[model samples]
Target: MRFIIDVLLTGLAVFLAALVLPDSAVSVAGFGWAIVAGLIISFVNATIGTILRFFTFPLNLLTLGLISFIITVLMVQLTSYFMGSKFDVANFWWAAVFALVVALIQMLLDSLFKSKNRD
Candidate 1:
């Protein structure tokens, strides 16, 4: 159940990223690849993202939350590279916007599901 939910969330994130990033494109091969890529991305974010965040904590603090945007952009680019996809983000700013949109969509979906599950 949890695994399925995770995959769905990942698909949603990918879809959101694709929608926001003009250069980001997902092939119709199947959602399976998307789910797999999403899992890999999640793992990378959980591990590497933690370390990067820790190291950049000071800079993040100084920037007053702006650094997180940069972090998300990096993660997206890394994910694209890992998947060997042609998801060309225009720049960091576009990546940041994509990340923000993806986050918002994921959050909304998670919240909706969680609320229903609690009922």
Candidate 2:
């Protein structure tokens, strides 16, 4: 189904993002682990992430939406903590970098899929 494909594609994007970063910054054990991490990230973003974002809406507006980026970084750290060694981030900065990369790749993947779906 579409949901399954989205998860798989998001996992692929996470794996690609991990490869794009330095090992010291972000690293994944393998594709399987990347899938696991990606699913967790998506779930976390959907649930806890939504609540946090809603609460931070005012701050996000004050900062021109910079707070959303912070929320994303925290989500990355939470994902790393849940994943243990399989998915790791060196520190806050690296997690931010990883989050940015993952966001970019996910955006790209979504665009591609949407375009193809329309075609």
Q: Which candidate is the best by lDDT?
A: 2
Q: Which ten residues in a row have the lowest lDDT in candidate 1?
A: 21-30
Q: Per-residue lDDT tens digits of candidate 1, residues 7-116? A: 88877676666655554333212456556657766787788887999899999999997776677678876776766643445455665676777778888888777744
The C-alpha lDDT values of all candidates are 0.68, 0.89
Cα lDDT of model 2 by residue, 16-35, tens digit = 99999999889999999999
RMSD of each: 3.1, 1.9
Q: What would the TM-scores of all predictions be?
A: 0.76, 0.91
Q: Which stretches of candidate 1 lie over 4 Å from their true place?
A: 20-30, 86-90, 115-119
* Local lDDT at 71 for model 2: 86
